[model samples]
Target chain A: MTLQIAGGLLIIAATTLIGWDFSARGARRVRDLTELKKSLILLKSQIDYSIYTLPQAFSHISPRVAAPFDEFYAKLAKDVEGGADAASAWVSAVHSLKNSNLDKTDLENFAILGMSLGAMDSGVQINSIDMVITNIDDSLKRLLAENPKNSRMYRGLGIVAGLLITIVLI
Target chain B: MDITVVFQIAAVGILVAVLNQVLKGAGRDDQATMTTLAGLIVVLFWIISYVSDLFGTVQSLFQL
Candidate 1:
């Protein structure tokens, strides 16, 4: 009967629609997780490079200030809970810094950038992690510009970004 | 005013909520948020057309 055939078609259409919706959602989630894994790796590598460079800068400062920097770095390493990567470690470090003697405004800014690194805005051009790295690189460049002694801080920034770029492309 | 349509709308709402929660748990918060928004818009469109029809009928009977 025509009525029976129409009913069957309607049922099929409804089922297909629901199935498609679920599949689309699942695909999006999978894609997001894959992207996050890559980003986390990129972040880890970048942080390690930064940590390596920090020592050179630390040496440039007076010995009295070295204790504070050491304390800061040690606290950071502890907070990340062995993230096994630079980005996670950096965020963990930043969190510890916030709880310590760092200026409140600076802490807030750092936290905002850290949160943005993981924010998923479709309209955002750069991933949050990249943006944070860029900000840090830019800040270093500016500080080095004002005082040449700080140039060592920016040495490995490009390498870090390049590493992330390769990981993303791969 | 039909009970059948009300039930269908309710079903759509429940489906949307379940879909949103599943997507969120999978760590696709962006897509999960979008799906909930999109589902709401689709359901609103469906209900709006029926409400418009009802209003049209009421207007004609009341001459307003």
Candidate 2:
């Protein structure tokens, strides 16, 4: 009887954790998007004010952003300094990101932003950054609208699912 | 037969009803329907052996 109870508890705990994890993803994505926007805005200011080359600008801004992105920018700076072109360096840095909260669409948008980074004039580069910022804004709005309902539903679902599994097993 | 099976089925029905409401409230009507269907299937799986046993008894009584 004790063994059965322990097993049931284990099952409940696992399923509940899974549900919580799934729901938490939306909020994490929101944080990641916000950070990306902040970093890009900083990049824009770097471009507008300083005459630093792309690598120098990235290295300077890398420390200012949050983790994952700080590492992302730092890697981009290193790659650019290592003689990789801006576009490829950006793509590689983006691809190298591990366990990032940003989803596929966000990553794809960032990759597209890379294509215009160093290949174009400063005016075009700033415009591209502006475009990405706008995209992040739209995504943030949608996520904020959807997150509450999703979080509640998933949390409830998780607990109820755990209970159901426990009942079935017991 | 264990009476606990009936209680388990009732518990499942309640949980599934709550889950269905949650999914529907979240604007996931398709998922709500799917959850209801899945719950029904799970209950059926639990009771299927008893259902077969009942049929067997009836067949033996009727000598059919």
Candidate 3:
């Protein structure tokens, strides 16, 4: 009886953790998006005010943004310095990201933004950044609205599923 | 054949019902339907042996 109880508890704990992780994913995405927005704004100001080249701008911005994004910009700076053009460098840097919460669509937007980064005049570059910012804003709004309900559902499902499995096995 | 089987079935029913409501309230009606079907299948699996046993008893009693 003790063994069965312990095993059941283990199953419940594992499923609950899985559900919690799933719920946290939305919040992580929101944090990543917000950080990306801030970093892009900083990059915009860097472009507008300084005569820094793209690589220099990226290196400067790298240390200032949050984690994962800081790594992203650092990689971007490294790739650009290694003789890759801005667009390809951007794409490669984005591809190198690990454990990021941003989904495929978010990554795609960033890739599109990269294509215009250093290949265009300052006005075009700023316009592309603004467009991505708008997209992030929309996604953030949607996530914020859906996250609470989705998280609750996942948590409940996890515990209930654990119980069902335990009961079946017992 | 055991009382525990009945209790397990009841527990599964309650849990599945809660899960279905949760999925539905989260606007995932498709998942709610799927969960309900899954629960039904699980219950059927549990009782299928007993059902077969009942049929065997009936057949023997009829001497057919």
Which number leads on DockQ?
A: 3
lDDT (Cα atoms) of all candidates against the true structure? 0.46, 0.91, 0.90
lDDT tens digits by residue: candidate 2, A51-102: 6799999999999999899999999999999999999999888897647999
Which candidate has the highest lDDT of all?
2
Q: Per-residue lDDT tens digits of candidate 1, residues A83-130?
A: 334345546655655434334443454555444432334223135445
Q: Which parts of model 2 are misplaced by more than 4 Å?
A: none
> Looking at candidate 2, what is the lDDT of residue A133?
92
Computed on C-alphas against the true complex, the DockQ of each candidate is 0.01, 0.88, 0.92
Shift in Å, residue B57, candidate 3 = 2.3
Candidate 2 chain A, poorest ten consecutive residues by summed lDDT:
A90-99
- The DockQ-derived docking category for candidate 3 is high
**lDDT of candidate 2 at residue A170, scale 0 to 100:** 80
Better of 1 and 3 by TM-score: 3
Q: What's the interface RMS deviation of candidate 1? A: 19.6
The 10 consecutive residues of candidate 2 chain B with the worst lDDT sum are B4-13
**Candidate 1: lDDT of B34?**
84
